[model samples]
Every structure is written in C-alpha cells, then in structure tokens.
Target: MKLQDQPPLHLTYGLSIHPDETWPELWASIQEKALAVRARVAPGKAFGLGLRLRDAVSREMAEGGNLRRFRQFLDENGLYIFTLNGFPYGRFHGGRVKEQVYAPDWRTEARLDYTRRLADLLAVLLPDGVAGSISTVPGSFKPWIHGASDVERITDQLARAVAHLAGLKEKTGREIHLGLEPEPGCLFETPDELIRFMQEWMWPRGRVRVARELGCSLAAAEQKVRLHLGVCLDTCHVAVCFEDPEEALRQYQAAGLRISKIQLSAALEADAVGRAALARFIEPVYLHQVVADLGGGRLRSWLDLPEALAALGSLPEARAVRVHFHIPLHFEGGGGLRSTTFALRPSFFRALQNGATEHLEIETYSFDALPGGASRDVVESVAGEYRWVLQRLVRAN
Candidate 1:
C-alpha cells in the first residue's frame, strides 16, 4: 500500500491531536506515523494536520518568531494546517484536559477577539509553502437573539471576521478561507439557516441569484464578494439534526455553498430494545436511531455515513471532504479512558475498499478526558489508535 496505488482522489487524508504533550515528542511520533501511513498507502500524500481548538501552544507557535519553527515543523513532517477546530466553546468548566479552555462564554465579542488574534497568528504561521488554510469558529456572539435581528447581527459579525481573514490571506499571500460551522445547539444549526445568513447578513450585495433578489448588501452593492463563507459540514451535527445527509448536501450545493470542512464521525443508532436500553446509560446526544436487518441481527452505527460519502464522491464540483473521527470514552473513578471503544465497522471498510472515498483523518481528541486520562499516555494511546485505523483502511483498500 503505497501512494501511487491509491485512487487519484485519495490524497488529502489526515488527523488531529492536542498539543498538550511536548511538540518535539508529539512531532516525532506523528512524523513516524504519517510516514508509515504514506509508505503503506499513497506514499507521498501525508495525512494533513487539524490544529485542534484547544492547542494554545500551537496557537502560540502561530505567532512571534516561533512561527518559523512551526513552519519548519510542517515541512519536516509533511503536514499542513487544515482547520482550527474551536472546541469546548460552551460553559463546561470542568471535565477533561480541554474543559478549562472550553470557554462557553465565547460570545461574539470573545470569538471576534480570538479571530483577530488568530488572523495575526496565521500572518506568521501560514505564509508560502502552506497547503491550505481555514479560520476559527465565530463565538456564539448572541445566543438570545435567534430570529431575524439576531441573524442580522451574526451576519455582520461573520462578515467582519471574513474580511479580516481575507486581509490575513492578503498579508500571507495565500488564500485562507474561513468556514462558519453550525453546531447542534448553536445559533447557526440548520444548513438553511447558515445559507440564509451567508446570503443576507454576510454578503448582502449578493453573488448568488437569491442574494440579488433580496437586495441585502449594504456597504458595497456592486462589489462581488468572493463568498469565503461556507459550512463546516459535520456528519454528527447533520445526523443529530435528523436531516437526510444526501439531501442536505445537495441543497448546500444548489445554494452555491462550499463545504469548507467535513467532520467525519459515526452516530450510533440502536435497535428497538437496544435503543431503549442504551437510553438508560447515555443521553440522547450520545445516542441516535438507525436501521437494522432483523434477519442479520447487527447494529447500525451510521444511518447513511457511507451513502452520504458515495453521494459526495459522485458530485463533480463538491468541496474536498476531511474526515473527522471521534473515539468513544468511558468515565470511571472520576477519570477517562480511550481505546477500542468504537472501531470503524466492516461496512465502512468495504466502502473504502471499493474506492468510494478520498480523505481519512484520525480525530480522537477527547482522549485526554476519558476515565484515568493522564496526559502522559494520551499521545501514545491515540497514536496507537491511529496506526490501527490506518492498517484497517489499507487492508480494506
């Protein structure tokens, strides 16, 4: 399994990890793992980097003269900055290694402030030699204002963030697009809401026909906005919303929206008895519904993960999708643990074997919060899990 043998479309696979462990130690392990992945499948296409939302060290590295070190690290390791995941944005102050930084109080002002800092940071972090770039999430800004006026306010704030990112792109001499992700409980939850907001509030002057009809643009009606705004496209978010993924993706395409990033996660759907039983152990967020072959007697994890992906691959102009994998964890004795709690099923492996996809990312970031989750062993555990996933994918391919 070398790079040349893989499908032409399967080049952008990758993963994400917190920068809590020492960078030298983490980089060493990551480089070795990525190189092994490259050697095994699609030799030269090293898994890109997903700078998690809570990596203050990486964020700091994105600033000051240290950015040279960071850039050198990417070059040396064959990785690129994909997206800065704004995690733990809610008010949960305690739980895992990330909870402390997960500022749910992240209002629009706080997010704007973070974005400003991030833009400046990227000015140094991602210049030439970088593959692609993305902006941080927009802080909730205003949760109470959910109707038209709230949408309008969010639009203005988002526009400002995009313009700022555009300026960062100009300074860096690279096109770093900022994607506004709609979380499950956030203001911009539905795809329709995000699309509408982008049209009226973000780019009122209108690039699409829908925008032109609304007469929305305020400052520069004739100016053509590049529409750097788009959706993050998380599978879990879509699944939780109970939207038909294939249909949702089509609507997004029809609206002329770009899927800036794709979060690939599995939603565990249980059968009648199992659903009722599992409901007793975990909350609904951790539980979802799925179909089962009464004859086969197996569980259905992803209602349409494969179907959604196959549909995506069929689209000629769809945005590049980045896989975001989340491993399950159990809390015991006031701690956490991450192992083979959830592994990629055979059906998904079969989908990959049939060449039904492009990218694969290892995203088990909450590992540090698992029961007995000591930071000392997290990277090793996560790196091992990464190796396991790669081996399975290669074997299936």
Candidate 2:
C-alpha cells in the first residue's frame, strides 16, 4: 500500500525545546520558533504540534479566550495540536530539575488535577476526527513509594485520571488518552513493570472504578481502561535500559496496551574506552540516570550521572553504560560518546511500518544542555530534526 493510503502518523516535535513556562513566552515561541520551523520543513502541509504546557500555562491557555485565539493561530499558520508533554508539571529548565521532576506524581490529587486541565485544553485544541494524547509521569519516583499502601494510593489516583479521561470521551467524543511515560529510576521504569501494573493494579481496581462511573459492565470497563490508559514509548529511555524496541513493543501489544505516542530521541552510550569521555554530560539542569551493565546479567543503576561517574572505576565488570540524555535524532555519536541511535532507528521504523501509534514526536528537549548548544539556533535545530524524521519515514515507506 502507498504511504498516503495507510493511516497517517502525525509527525511533530515537542515545544519543550523552547524553555517557555508562561503563555506569553509560549505564544511568542509559536510565532517566532514553531511557525518558522513549520515553514521550513513542511511549507504548505498542515503541521502537527506536540505541545508542552506547564500547569500554570495550561490554566492560562484555558482562560481569557486564549484557547480560541490559539486555535485561530493554528488555522492561520497551518498547525494543529495532536499530543501534549504533560510529564513535567513545573519549570523544566533554567534550574536544577533532578528527581524533583517527578514530583506530584500520580499519587497526588495535584497530578490528577493538572492532567485533567491538560485534557480539557487538548479537547478544545484538537481538530475534529483526530485523537489526542497526553504523556504523564510513571506513577511516582520508585524510592518514594515504599509499601503496599503507597502502591494502592498511587494506583487509585491514576484510576481517577483514567476515569476522568473516560468522561472526556463520553462528553466530547474526542478520545483523548493518557500516556504514562516510563523512565529509568522511576516507578514502572521498564516494560515488564508497566505490564505488571496494568495486570495487577490498573485492570483490577481501574475496571471496577470505571465500571461504576460509566455505568458499564466489567468487560466494557476493561476495554475503556485499555483505550484510555497507554504507554508513551520514549526511545531514549528504552535504549538506556538496554531494551530491545521490537520485543518491548511486542510485549505491550500482547498485553492489550496501546502505544500512545513514540518519543523519538537518542541516549548516550559508552564503553570502557569512552567511559571517561561521558563526564562532559554531567550537567546540573536535569537528572541523568545511568544504567551500567555488568556481566552475568547484572545491571548497576545510579540516580544521577555524578553517582555513576564516581563509581565508574569501582565496577570493574562494567561493559557498557547508557545515560538518560536526550540527544539529537540525526546525530549518531560524538566526542567519543556514542548514541543509541542505531538501536532506536530500526525499532522506530519497525513501529512506523507496523502502525504502532498515530503520533510520532521528535523530543530532543535537552538541546541547550548539549555541548556548544547555547549558540545554536533553536528554530533551525527543530526544523532539522523534523526534516530528518520525515526523510526516514519516506525511505521506510
């Protein structure tokens, strides 16, 4: 079948690359950066936007007729929003984000409120007949959630979010899904953990809750949970955990889970020779969780790059280390530090070929943290990533 005949995968890049937390800054970015990028890469074609709105900005967009105005801007500029990066709730850049990025995780009412607001905004912004996705935190930070009660509390909160989504679908008929994006050192970091959550927590408790709320049978409620709650597969996070993308995707599919959105990104990989070279990646802005593979299937994981670097020499059996760093999609490796690009590309293309999801977002949100990135033009960089992915998709087709 021809590419146009198949279901169209909405290709776009996340707006998080621009460190704008307020509405004015965000609107300026759309006009100055987002529009310019679209003009260069897509020209007259309708460009999709993977919007990243913090809690404050989300509230701002929903009020004062901002949503209507923004929709008008999208129509005039040939743009539309298909997905949102709801993972980060507060300021993502210009500060030390560290483990705090996962604060107000699925355990709290605040997370639920924030996500509900995002869904409300997305429902208004999404064009007719197009489904939308909002990628959120993977429960809470693993270390913080101690025991059975913690798990139950977090799961209950998440169920509330899922129930809210079901209500939105019933009310708006837009079918917006919440994608729990898994990352290293967080709850449900790997595919297996995510699957287990679905079977143990989500399916059991969520089905009953949804059934009661929607007044449907258990089977129908189960189906609703499957449709609304899904995974946002971040290529960089999967690669850093040394997961085979094809196998992971297969596992998610087998579990009746939907792939909400594919976050197209690359991670930093290093062997012993290149181990010392990764020191340059030690930045203060975000937490760079590093997973070191020891022989005999043992993996040593650290909370941050500094911890990993400090113990690099002690782990003599360490063969390779993958850091949670979002690098440009087009660049493979540099400065003796390799990227998991090779592993990511084939798997991403495989998913594309199989129609894994409708949304494909290039999410290299760490451009400013990259070496010599301060001088780089954000608009051109975003446009370049879009062009690179577009070319790859065409070739894959």
Candidate 3:
C-alpha cells in the first residue's frame, strides 16, 4: 500500500494542536514548533509532520520561493511531511469559529482553488515516491446542504479537484489525494449518509463530470477520482457519534472506500451527574456537537454542545453523553467527566497495525483551553499522546 513514505506506520503531529496563532507569524512558528516537538518526541529519528494550512498562508507559501525554502529546512532537519489538515479554510482558533469553519465549503470555487494550491505545495514538499494526503471538510455543515443542487455543486467542485490532482500526478510523480473529513455536525456525519453520498452523488455523477473535464474515459476517470478522493476517519469524531472505530473502519472498507488517514483523538464523556461540570468547556472557538444516549439502543443528537446542555432538561432519560470536544488521547476523568479513549480498543490498534492506512496523525484541537490543560506544555502533551498511542500499537502487534 506504499506505506514506506514515512516509515514505521507514518505517525505525525497536527500543528493545529497549537491553534492560537497562524499565518505570517505562523510561518516562523511552524519551523520552531515542529523542531521543538521533534526534539522532545523523536530526537534520534526522522520526524513526520501533519501540517495545517489556510488559504492566506497557502497563497504565501506558493510564492517567493517559500516552498523551496521549506523543503530545504525539512531536508536539513530530520523531518518530513506526509499529511495535511485542509479541513479549516481559515482562522481555526483564537476567535468564534463555531460553524463558520465550514464556510466556503466544498461548493465554492475558492475551496477548489485553495485545495489545488495545497496540492502544488505538497507536490514539492513530499519525499521521493511518498504519497501525500490532504484531509478536508465533509462537503459542508449538514444544515447548509439544502437540496440536490447543493449536493450537485459540491460533487462537481470536488470532481474538479480530483481532475487537478490527476493532472498534477501526470506532471509530477507525487501521488497526493484529497480526503473529506466527516465531523459530528457535518454533511456526511453518519456512515449511511457518507455511503449514500459517495454511491449516489460521487460515483454516478461526480465521476462523469471528472471524465468530461479530464478528457478521459469513464473507467479512467473513476479510477482517478476514487484514488484521489476518500474519507479521513477521525477516531474522536466517530466516538462522539457513538460509533465503534473498528466497525466503522470495516463499513468504510466494505463500501469500497479508502481510509485516507486516521486522525487520533479522544472525545469527552460524562453522565448527567457531570453535566454541570461540562459548563467549563463552554467556549466560543469551536463547535462541540453532543450525542445523548437515550437508552434502549436509541441516540439523540444535538448540533452543538451548548444546545445539548440546554435541552438536557426536556430530553428523554439518558445514560451518558459524549461531546465532540477533541480532548487529549491521554486524558482521564476529572470531577466526574471522563474521556472516550476507551473507545480506541485493542482491536482498533490492531487494525491500524495491519496497515488500514499509511497516514496516522495524532490530532486534538484547542485542548489547551480546557481547565488545567493551560498549565501543561504543548510539546510534552503531544509527546505524551505519541507515547501512549505507540505503546498500544506495539502491544497490539
């Protein structure tokens, strides 16, 4: 499966973990922060970077020989990039990002242009014969997709991206693919929804569009689209929706979908007793979708965490609640609240060890905003997560 890109299962850190600053300043921040994390985590080995870039930074990096300079930097250090978090179009933190993070969603030409720029940058940055992956938003927020035309527009835009990627591969030998990352409140949050969208919209119409655009046969276009487009299986997001990771991976594979990358994160969980403690997490930066277990194999979902807390009084009797907050993988209970790390069972690690995907990115957003988390060091925290995950992976093997 071309897993030799960044060997040893290709584990990397999401620069988004330090989400407070980006662009201009972030350009320098990345060089320093990446070196810092590498020194603490894997001082003696080559470090893998799961980079994040927004439209503005991407534009800057594309010009002025910046791409070449960054490549030189990586080559000088024992560092390499295998994956990118392209989900956030701009400004992921330090303000009210809430649902606006999904803006300029897959339907807009802006999104398409931004993605192509990233591909160009990655084409130069990737190592020889190493495949690259970019994880993007899941079409759009679920509420934003109103009708068939919206779906059509999103599909058409994505097809254009696939065609661009195909052309890039033709010119450059780098094989970079785009992955649609499904979040709890996004368009393809559930397995059935993702399957239906791919089978109905992408497979039938999107491929035809790609074929026409690329001036290739339907079969050739289909192969290119499937090869370049797939799902970014996020562990915390699936857990937030009360879905099993191993089973979810099985469903995706059974549906003939590729696991572009696996984002390693842990969600927050608490029962009714701890509902009040959850108030501490009420922030304006990110959307925390909540899923309530209504018992008898039933689940009720809220688009945001605050909404779930507000409706908890009127909702049916519940057993536990899982929040979309991407807590640190090593996080445990505190004042009645706990982590969903348990969801990442031994089977999950086993599946990963068996080459479910070549890209493994440890991802958690704005965890420093949590209580007591602010006091912890970002490098140490991320290093701790790497240690924890690597231990489990070794045990599973």
Best by lDDT: 2
Q: Which ten residues in a row have the lowest lDDT in candidate 3?
A: 1-10
lDDT of 3 at 60: 82
- Runs with alpha carbons beyond 4 Å of true place in candidate 2: 1-5, 345-348
Q: State TM-scores per candidate.
A: 0.60, 0.96, 0.96
Count of backbone collisions in candidate 3: 0
Higher lDDT: candidate 1 or 3? 3
Best first by TM-score, ranked: 2, 3, 1
Between candidates 2 and 3, which one is better according to lDDT? Answer: 2
Instruction: Give the alpha carbon lDDT tens digit for every residue of 251-310 in model 3.
Output: 998998878999999889988788888888888788889998999999999988788889
RMSD of 1: 10.7
| Model 1 / residue 333 / CA error / Å | 25
Clash pairs, candidate 2, are none
lDDT of 1 by residue, 7-62 (tens): 42222322333433344544554566455644554446544555443344445555
To one decimal, what is the Cα RMSD in angstroms of model 3 from the true structure?
A: 2.0
Global fold similarity of model 1 (TM-score): 0.60
lDDT of each: 0.45, 0.86, 0.85
Give the alpha carbon lDDT tens digit for every residue of 1-397 in model 2: 0124256567888989996788898888788888888788877878788888999999888888889998998988878998999999999989988989999888788999999999999998898888899999999899998887888887777777778888988898989998889899999899999999999989987788778877889898888889999999998999889897767788898988889988888899998888988888889999999999998888999999988999989887899899999988776675567878777555458567667888888999999998788899888888778777777776665
